[model samples]
Target chain A: MAKEVRLWEGNHLVAEAAILAGCRFFAGYPITPSSEIAEYMAVRLPQVGGTFIQMEDEIASMGAIIGASLAGVKSMTATSGPGFSLKQENLGYACMAEIPVVVVDVMRGGPSTGLPTHPSQMDVMQARWGTHGDHWIIALAPAFIHEIFWATVRAFNLSEKLRIPVILLLDEILAHMHEGFRLPDSSEIEIVDRAKPTVPPDRYFPYDESQGDVPPLAAFFSGYRFNITGLNHDKSGFPTTNPEIIQRDMERQRRKIERHLDEILWWDEHELEGAELAVIAYGSIGRSAHAAVDRARALGIRAGLFRPITLWPFPEKRVAALAEQVRTILVPEMNMGQLVLEVERVAAGRCDVVPLGKVGGIPIDPPEILEAIKARV
Target chain B: MAFDYEKYLRMERMPHMWCPGCGIGIVVKAMLRAIEKMGWSQDDVAVVSGIGCTSRTPGYLDFNTLHTTHGRALAFATGLKLARPDKHVIVISGDGDAAAIGGNHFLHACRRNIDITLIVVNNYIYGMTGGQASPTTPFGMRASTAPYGAVDPAMDICQVAIAAGATYVARGTVAQGLLLERYILNGLKHKGFSVIEAMSDCPVQYGRRNRMSSAVEMIQWIRDHGVPVTRAKELPPEELEGKFVTGELHVAERPEYTEEYRRLIEKAQKAAEGAHG
Candidate 1:
């Protein structure tokens, strides 16, 4: 079969990639910058014998996805800003319960509904610590239309592979941008299915830590009966308040993602081999920084770019290694210095970390990034 | 011969999360009886619940169950019903969970009229959270949050369901266990949205706050105070004023949400195929 390269909007690519990745269920309330995802799924899912429900609100949207996932389907929900806030509790539940589902947050300006139809990456920190409790999440920020398609596939793969809710953090620009992308054939895409218990139904335990951190999920009506509760539960899914069990359970939940950091972590590094000035960025801002890097190189300033694909694990080891070789790191984002703090903490005083912050519903200008790199040089 | 209730009960799991002498236990037993009489396989049933004392009913049942977040059981059950319409889907929730925090979802689920049975265990208070006044707490009834006496008018959940378009709506109390069981079985059998409000007692919080200290006292209050719909209809307009008429209050035939959705999809598919051919 001939490879088909097509011009697609970022949202359409994401929707198409999700369908190819076997996402049979999507429950999301439409929101700006992200509504196209819900719209595409509304039209496309039913054609493939899938389910798409527009929930009453984002909270119910998140809840429905969790339930659909338990029934042996790859489910997801998309939203931006305030809708993301409404989903925190159930996101915590998905984290604690180890339910595999994808959450797509197309970033917008906010503390609360600040800018509905504009671009801002203010949710960087919130995505990591928005939900209560100790949970390590896999968050990927795609810079271009092509990356949105692949990042969505990666999000589903990471969610199912680790049994954690993976987030695809797309900004308004990248989400709504139209660009050309090479659509991979179904055979070319690698899909990950949820782990299923090999143990007999009588011996199956829903939260069996000894059986490995990621237990196989049995679909409802699969003749494998198990309890799934938000409360601290034993191996058989029955609630237990024992301190020792609770301690071990919390550790297992954290370790499931932390232990597999190598597979979960991803990044894009450009020209950082022997560069003194490094620009750290992600999402749409990362694309802007890439252009700024090219402009700086044309001016004969040795500047490089480091974009984190996995935001939660923070890519600390990679950042720490890169920090040693760079004299100064310029962190430019659409938010008021959120990721700069992480870069500073990880850089550990080895390099000077500077943040070029913006939060008034505007993307960071490429010229500003160019100026920051010029100054560092 | 009467069914062996003890065999159905998971002895090791008890004493349950319910408070001592709580009517929730009785209501749960009634539900189990209804399930047994219907002869539905435990494996084929999926009980989804939200946070509250009533939501704990699924924890005791020997079936594939889910204990979900607060006030979201209906949403979760909707997904389950859509995914596998062949399975029996029952949502167990509290007055607060169903009518307060989850009020919008409750109304919309009724409006959708999907094939699912919802048992709103109305103990008249948020029992699990220490007797906070719920949407169904009686007017002028004392609660932890409403120490000065609840001045606001309480919600009538059955009326809300009936108005919201539930196909079958009924009200029963712990005092009417056999009748409550019958209502639950009927609700389960109904092919659309079926709501059974199981009036229960919260002796620890609600009972103490409202001065009905004992579970037996609460049962007596329900028995003496509840006016049957048939009897209320016979009373004069003046005599029947200001009283709650409890029974199978409403039953109607309506197209279920999922069935209608399927029909629309089929029609669209056939149209597309016809157009192409």
Candidate 2:
């Protein structure tokens, strides 16, 4: 088949990719920079025999997607900062219940509703820790319009494979940008569906860990009259207060991601061989970091760009290795140094960690990053 | 032969967490009886609930049960129903869970007229949190938060459901168990959004704070104040003060949300096929 090349807008590609990823249900409330995903899904989902619901609020959107997911459908919801805040409790429910659902938070400037129309990486930390409780999350930050499509696909795949909520972190620029990319043939794309129980309904346990860290999730109405709850539960999926059961399940939930970090972590590094200064960036800022690295190398600065596509689980091992190889790691982001803290924490005084933090709704331009790189040199 | 309650109850999950004389168990029994009367298999039903004593009903039910976050059971059930329209979906919520923090979802669920039956157990107070004044706490009722007296007017959940466009609306109390069961059965049969507000007793939290301290006293109070809709209509407005009318309060026909969406999908697919052909 001839490669199907096409030009695509950012948010529209998210909707298309989600469809390609077999997402049959979407429930979302409108929020700036992310509303286009919902709008596109509204028109597109029905055509593909999928369901799209414009829920009453962000909380409902999150809850709806989780519900759909529990009923054996791949589901997603999109939101920005304020909406993301409203979704925390339900997001925590998804995490606790071990339901597979994807949440896309198009980054916007905000502590509250700081800047709706502009972009920021303020939600970098929030995506991982926004939901209450002790749980690990897989968040992907796609740098370009094409990557947004693939990232959304991967988000669903990971969410299903791991039985956890995956966050697709897109900034305002990446969310609204236009770019061209070649679409893979249907056979070329990889799609993952959640594992189903091999045992009969009576023998099925929703959280049975004897199978593996990621238990088989029996869909509701699939002859599995099982219980799913937000409360701490045992393998039978009923709420339990037994200290040992609670601890084991909590540990298992954390290990579900931590044990598979290598499979879950994804990133692209440029020109890092024997580089002295490493520049770390993600999302829209990654575009600038790539350009800045090229500019720095042309000037004999030996600066490399390490863009983390999978932001959480934070690529700690690789970042620590980079710290050992490089003299300095310069972290640039749209927010006032969110992921940089992770870099610093992992770097752990092994190398000088410099943060080129930028807020106020402006993209960190290549020249600014280049200037920082030159100064580091 | 006695009703086989054990057939529907998760034997291991009992005895339930509700306080003694709490009417949540009665409401749950009524719901189970309704479910059984509908002739739906336990596997074909999905019982979802938010955070509350009433919301805990799903935990003890032998069905596809989901104990969701606070105030979001209806929203969650909305998605579940849309995904599996074949499955009978029901949301069990409490007064605070349905009318306070979750009020927006409740109103919107009614407005959407989705094929969902929401059984709002109106205990008048937040029993889970120990007698906090909820949106439905009666005026002048004593609660822990409103120690002096509840100054705010109580919300009539049935009226809210009716006004918000629910296709079927009914009010019943735990005192009239069979009536509540009948209303629930009717709600399950309704094609669109159905709200059955079961006025239940939170004897430990709500009744104790008010004058009715014992379970019998609370049940007597409920039995006394609940007037059948037919009799209440005959009584004058002043004579019906402080009395709630039981039985079906509202019924309107509209396109159910899931069915409408299915038609929409067919239309969209046809258009897409036409474009492709």
Candidate 3:
């Protein structure tokens, strides 16, 4: 059979890809810009013998996905700005409890529901630090419509394999866009499941790191009964106040992600062959940055694009390398200077770092980014 | 023969954090007895709780227990029940955890009529938080936050559960141990959402602030104020003033949520197959 091509909306593709990725449960509350994900899940999940629940609110939605995950179901939830804020508490719970869940925040204009229908990447930092305390997070920003499907599948893979929550960040534009793409065969996709304990129920510990950094997690009803608490806990998953245990466990959780950066971080570089200027962007604005880079190159300016697919665990070494090779790096984003802060820190005055920040609830067009690239060159 | 409570408990984790004379122990015993009577496999039961003194019950139980964030136990339990319909999911929460911050989840869970039993320990005060007034604190009850006495009217938890569409709604006091166990057992056996408002005592915090300064006095007060629902109806409003009606307050039959979803799945699968055909 020739490759089957289908026209799919971005949010609908996320729901479809979740099913293909073995996401068997979805719980969410309706919110603008991301509601289509929930709507499609409601219709599609049951068809695949999966469960979908419209929870009472965003907090409950987050809590439900965590619960489903603990019960050994691959689970997810999707929301927008205000809803994402409401999910922070349980999101933190998922972090502390080390439950693998996928949360999609289709970004819209916000400080507080500033613009409901328009696209904005204002939640770049929030995805990294929305939940309180020092916890590990893996956030992926996929630019293209087709990438959203694979990115969601990858989100589930990372979430389950690393035993941590994964945030897939999309702006309203990508969430609402329609595109025709080939659906890959099921045999072509790689799926990762959480490791199960080899020990009998008698000796099982939910957070044991002796086996590896990411402990094997047993399903709730799989004859392995263990405790899960939001409090700082010991390897047995019981709450503990011992400073030694707390310090060891907290460090282990961080190392679980940090040591695996080689597996977690992803980015793309374009035309960086002795380029004089590089434009760093992600999410919807990444498309504009790519266009502007090509335009600048056509205008006889040495411009390149560094689009980060994995926003967190920033591509420090690559961008720093780019900083050395290029005279200037222009970072354009939907929000007022979020990712640029990280870029600036990594550059450390080795090269000039400029930010083209916008929050007007619109995409930063190619010409605008090209103008920034021109000034720097 | 004496019952082996230790068989169901993680004895190493105790002595528990509950203060002396706390009625939470009584509620825990009743729940264990009910579960024991039901003969449930320990591995198949998942006990969940939110933040509060009562929420500590799950930490002691030797089951698949989850100590979740404050007021979200029901929300979490909902997901667990839906994901693993074969597992027996129960939630333990305090008045403030259930009816205050978790109030939205509480109402929606009842309305959804999912097959899960919720035990809300109504201690009338936020006992874990140094005796702050809770939603269940009586209008004139003294608490740390209600120094002059609580100005807000107390909530009738059983009534709220019944009105919110819980298929089984019951109230039992710690003063009535065996009866409390029976009510809990019935709630567990109910086919849909079951709410059991366990009227427990917070003698150390609530008792000291409200003049019932000892465990005995608090138990005695609850015993004196609790009238069986059948008898409560015989009394006039004036005669029933400042009293609570206990026992099984409401029972109705409804389609359980998970079972309904199973049917939905079958229909959806058929429709999808037909579309493909």
Candidate 4:
């Protein structure tokens, strides 16, 4: 087959990639800047022998995906700000239970439904620490339509690999914008699936620690009948109050994603060879940051771009390395210093971390980031 | 021979987390007995529950059980049933969890008519949270939060399930153990949405605030008010006033959600292949 360049919207590409990545179940409630993903899946999933449920609400949507994923299907749900808030409880449940599923939050302005149709990267911290309790999640964001497709595919792979919920965070710009990109064939994509139990049905434990940090997931209806609960549990999947077991499981949940950060995290750097200053951003802001870096280099100032696709793990080590090479690091986001705080925490005393945050539903243009770059240089 | 509950129960998680003389254990045993009677494999069944005194029942069961968030058991079960139609999914939830916080899910699950059995343990008071007035708390009944007496009218759960289009709706009191087991078994056998509203007792949280203070007193109260649907037909309207009717309330025939979705997939795939051809 010849390579086909298709004009695709970011949300549409997400649904397309999800289908290719073996996501057979999607339960979602529509929210602005992300509804197309669900709408597309509604028509597409059934044709592909998948299930799509428009749940009663965001909470139900999140709950449904967790349920479907447990039944040995790759499932997902998409939402925006307010809906995202409603999903936090079950999102935490997925974390504690280690159910592999994908969640997409197309970012819109909010503390509560602030901007429904406009762009904002405000969910950076919400994606990291949205749900209550101590847990780890892999959150990936994309700057354009092309990466949105690849990011969603990677999100499923990482979610399945680590047996955790991975968040694909996109803002209004990347979520709604139409762009041209070469459609990748599913056969060429490296897709990862959840491992099934190697033990017999009698010995199969849902949270088997002996298997590895990320235990093999036993299909719910499979003869390996095991329990799954939000409460801290032993390897048997029965809720436990034992102190050592609790600590061990909590640490296991954290290490499953944290220790495998090399396998879980992804970022791209541009023109950082002896650059005196760097621009750090993600999602749509990274798009502008990349353009700004090029403009800075054209003006004889060394400016590098460090855009993180994996947002939750925060790419701290790479950020610190960039901080050392650059005298000042410019961190621009839609939210007021959410990721910049992490950047500062990691790069503490290594360099100056300047934040360029814009609220009230507007994208930070390249010139503003370039000005930050020029001033720092 | 004595039935081996240990065959189906996760005995290690015991002593099970339920109050003394709580009705949840009876309901759990009835469900297990029903499953045992049906001879379904533990692997072929998935019991899901919400957060409540009743929702904790699944943790003690040997099936592929899930203890989910409050009031969302049905929604979760809906997804599970849809994805794996081969498994018989069942939801066990409390009154407050099912009708109050999870009320929307309860009604919609009925409307969708998916193949799942929902056994709602309607204990008038919120027993897990120290006797807050629940949606099923009869008017004028006292609870910890309803010290002045509950003002909200108690919801007729079976009526709502029937109105929402559940294919099978039945009523059973936890006090009527064998009868409740029969209703649960019949519910599991139903093809579409099946709901068994098992009126439960929360002696400590509810009974103490009202007239019935002890387990015996509460069980006696449940039995006294419980009217068999067959017997209620013979009683006068005034005599039957406020008396909850037990046994099967409604049964209907409808296409289940999962089967309908499968048909949709087959049709969709045919159309897609035709279009490609």
Candidate 5:
């Protein structure tokens, strides 16, 4: 079979990549920028023997994906700002219950419904802290069409492997933009299925930590008569009010994610051979930062780019290490200053963290990023 | 094999959080009996629930169960059913959880005609929240929120389910355990969306506050006014003024949601092949 070179929109590529990655279920409500993902899925999923539902609302869409995940399917949903906010409650439910799901939030500026068809990376902090309670969230942002497709696949792979939800963040520029896409050969790309229980059906405990901190999940109707609950439970999966058990559940949720940071976090670091300045950025903003770094280098300034592919574990150690190597680290974002606060907090006194925030539904350009680097240098 | 309630229930989770004399237990027992009678293994069943006293039913069931957040069980069950069409998905929810907060999901699930058995324990009040007025709370029934008495008329959940396109819709009182059990059995057997509204008594919440003094009085009220569909057909409309008919009130044949989607997949796959050609 010969591979086809296809022209693909960012959203279409995400849908194609997701199907290739074995996303058999998708439920979402239409919202701008994100609607293309839903539209593509609605037509494409059925052809691949997958289910696509335009739910009554975003809330149900979130709920449906969580349910499908619990039933042992690779499930996902796409939405924008308002829909993302609507999904927060069930996203928290997916976290507490340890259901593996993928949520794609195509950035459109907002505190409310800001700019529907324009790009903004305002959800950086919200992506991590949006859900209530203590939760380990893995979010991936892509700057271009190819990256969005890969991010969608990685989101599914990481979700199944980690037994937690993954958010694939894309700005409107990345989601709706059309580009020549080399159709990824499904067989060439690695895919991961969720781990199944090794124990006998009768002996199964849905939340059994004895198997591992991240317990193996048995599909709902796979003859494993286990239980799942949002409430904190013991090994038997019944709701436990026991304080020790509650503490254990909370600790395990936090510790499992923290321990696996090395496995989850992916970052980009450019030339920094005795460079005095570092520019840390993410999403589409990082694209500009990359170009700016190149421009700065041409201008005889020593600067490097550190782009974090994984947002939640926040690449703390990497940022901290980078901090020690530089006098100042400039953090630029499409938001007022969401990711910078995290960068600043981690950098500590090792460096002066400067923030270059951009809003009004527009992405910062290379010149803008170069200005930030020049001023800081 | 004889039906064994103990085999299906997790006794350790017992002394279930339901109040004394509450009818939620009866509904759970009836559902268990239905499962037992159907000869389905606990392994093949996924019992899901939203938050409330009735939602807690899945916690005690020795099945693949999920106790989810308030009122989203149908939406959750929709996904579960679609993912593994081989598994039977059953949802247990409360009056408020099903008809109030979760009503939109319920409507959509029915509209989809998804293969899910939703059995709502309509207790007329929010028992878990301490007797607040619920969607099914009768007009003039005093509740914690309606101290002076509920001024709004109650919403009939059966009509809502039918209107939402549920293939099977039925209402049964908890007092009539045998009959409710039969309807539940039929619901479990139904291939499309099925809704079994088990109108139950909340002795601690709605009963104590209202004129009903004991669980018996509440049970008696249903026993007296609850007319069977067969009998209601014989009686004049004026003669059955306040009586609500029980027994399988509605049954229709529709293409089940997941199965329809499966056909859609075949057609879409053929279309894609043609496009490739």
Candidate 6:
């Protein structure tokens, strides 16, 4: 039986859910929209035998999470625009080193601190490619408070399962807004622990591909002595400058995520049985788009909504398949047409791609989306 | 008869990468002595290091160790400590790695006051990358980049750590071998963020660039000029001016970052469980 949940702000729910998930280490600096996460962790982490640190800055916060993760703890950090920018370098290192960590970016208006307290979906590209080099990134965006809790849990599970960093992309509205969330009973959720090598210490190779794709992690002081590095490394994890080794290693790192695409991609479709116009969006904006699509349908328009939960390893095939059914696709984002370009590329001239975007942190009003959808219809 | 320190040493690997009579060797010995005194199971301690000549400390030791990227040892060690707070995490880094590129992390680690011991070997210049002036390079020190001499003054690491909220802050020199051992041990025992800045000699790069030619001469200079904070207090300001004050500068107690966080989690859990029950 589903019980009525009292209204809870998205940020509070995320913080509460983090505590429930057995997250014991949170190192972050305060920033707008995301400040509530740090504040909640600061007050809540200690009550549950967890550690909360407001680092000197975002770089240190990132470093601390990596440190905490290595110590065999589930660790996370929260940040916004500029702080996210400061974290890219270490984020790349975490990916290359195969460290399991969760980084929450409650994105704000930016280029450089453009709108500290406002919302923007401008970080989509940065979250994917801001870090140097080629590496797989798992990013999830939640549309509501309950989703924040579930998404954070998913972030941790994916991070440990893939042995890579997972990013939870929240916007200002969702991170700061209020919504009731039902806390899951402990038995309801499945938690995944990092894989420990079953091989004896003497025979263990840190990065040995013998496991097929995902290698087991040997915790420090485990008597399994094996090298770990950020450099392009062989299965033994020692530095290798060989081009073939570098190429193979990079592909393997990417393939580990790409090969599991079936389990990674997620989306929701609304009223698209025979739609001629499709509206695509994500994060908080997706919620608004859903309402706008409903309003359009009441006015005799064949407008539909498609919302993606997994932003990267993008559901290109799904979008392309949908494009074949629709004559036009409208993408509404909080940025200057970032996701729209992606939709256009995937649509591949089969459909008209229209971008409805706003800068300076103001969310695209539902009416603006409705009008766009109505015009397309 | 000196317990045959050489037996434990990696002899074949010698013709050490460090210059002749460098103080790093003395500091490493002191560290080893402290580790021995603690009687920690070697398997339970991980000596992590970042890129620098001092970073080589992990490679020569038999314990589980990690040699990480430049200026990121603390970051890596933080992960190691959080993952297993039961294990001893000792981070050995140079002035450049700890104070320059890693300055932000250094300050926050002090502020967080987690249970970790950081030994910063301050040679006052970027030795491994060539004699570039570092955040700790004294004013007017010549370096590859500062050919005209550095106009910016060096940062006092002990003062910075104290200001940044470290529970334990101390300064020692490799020249004072016994004192250095005591300081390292004290830092290890502090139970929170502890920083021991061992003023070391980089005779090869820093000394050559700044005109202090030999490592022995550098050690002798530190021994003659380094002033104890207690004794220096009696001396006039002008007399203590320009001299490096060496000793345990500060110690205090506060709820560490991890402990405080743990408390919050327990409280939240109790409230939730109570309400549900």
TM-score of each model, in listed order: 0.97, 0.99, 0.99, 0.97, 0.96, 0.89
Best-matching candidate per lDDT? 3
Q: Which residue pairs of candidate 3 clash?
A: none
- lDDT (Cα, tens digit) per residue for candidate 6, span A1-377: 23457777777777777666768788898888888888988777766667777777787788778877766688889999899998897898888988888998998998897889889998999888879988889899888787888888888888888898988999999988887667787788878889998999767766777776778887778776555666677776666789987887788888888888887787888988888999999999999999999999899899899999889878999999989999999999999888788888999999899999888778887899998887766
Candidate 4 lDDT over residue span B1-277, tens digit each: 8778999988777888798999898999898889999999888899999998999988888888999999999988988998999789999999999999999999999999999999999889789888999999988889888889888898999999999999999999989888999999999999999999998888899988887778888888898898988998899999976678998989899999999999999998998888878
Higher-scoring candidate on DockQ, 1 or 6 = 1
**A1-377, model 1: which lDDT tens digit per residue?**
24677688888788889999999889999889899999999877776777888999999999989988888889999999999999998998898788899999989989888999899988888899999887768888888887788889989998998889998898889888889878889988999998888989888888877678787788887888677888888777878899898898888888887788898888898878778999999998898899999899889888999998788878898889878989999999998899999999999999999999988888888898998888777
Worst 10 residues of 5 chain B by lDDT: B1-10
Candidate 2 residues A1-377, lDDT tens each?
A: 24777788899999989998999999999899999999999999999899999999999999999999999999999999999999889989998999999999999999999999999999999999998878878899999877888898899998999999999999899888889978677687899999999998878898887889999999999898899999999999888899999998989888988888887898999999979999999989999999999998899889998999999878999999999999999999988889999999999999999999999999999999999999988
lDDT of 3 at B80: 97
Which docking class does model 3 fall in?
high
DockQ of 4: 0.87
Between candidates 2 and 5, name the one with more favorable lDDT: 2
How well is each residue in B1-277 modelled by candidate 5, as lDDT tens digits?
Answer: 5557889888877778877778998999899889888888778899999998889889888888899888898888888888988878899999899999999999988898988999999888998888999988888888999999899888889989999899999989889999999999999999999999998998889988987758898888768878888999999999887567788989999999989988899999999999889
Count of backbone clashes, every candidate in sequence:
0, 0, 0, 0, 0, 28
The reply for model 3, stretches above 4 Å from the true place, is A1-3
lDDT of 4: 0.90
Q: After superposition on all CA atoms, how large is the RMSD of candidate 1?
A: 1.6
- What does the lDDT read for residue A65 in candidate 6? 86
- Cα lDDT, model 2, residue A71: 90
lDDT of 4 by residue, A48-108 (tens): 9999999889999999999999999999999999999999999999999999999999999
iRMS values for every prediction: 1.3, 0.6, 0.5, 0.7, 0.9, 2.9
lDDT of each: 0.87, 0.92, 0.93, 0.90, 0.88, 0.83
lDDT of 2 by residue, B128-157 (tens): 887999998888889999999999999998
| By DockQ: ranked, best first | 3, 2, 4, 5, 1, 6
Docking quality tier of candidate 5? Answer: high
By descending TM-score, how would the candidates be arranged?
3, 2, 4, 1, 5, 6
For model 1, the superposed segments whose C-alpha errors exceed 4 Å read A1-3, B6-8, B236-242, B271-277
Model 5's TM-score against the true structure: 0.96
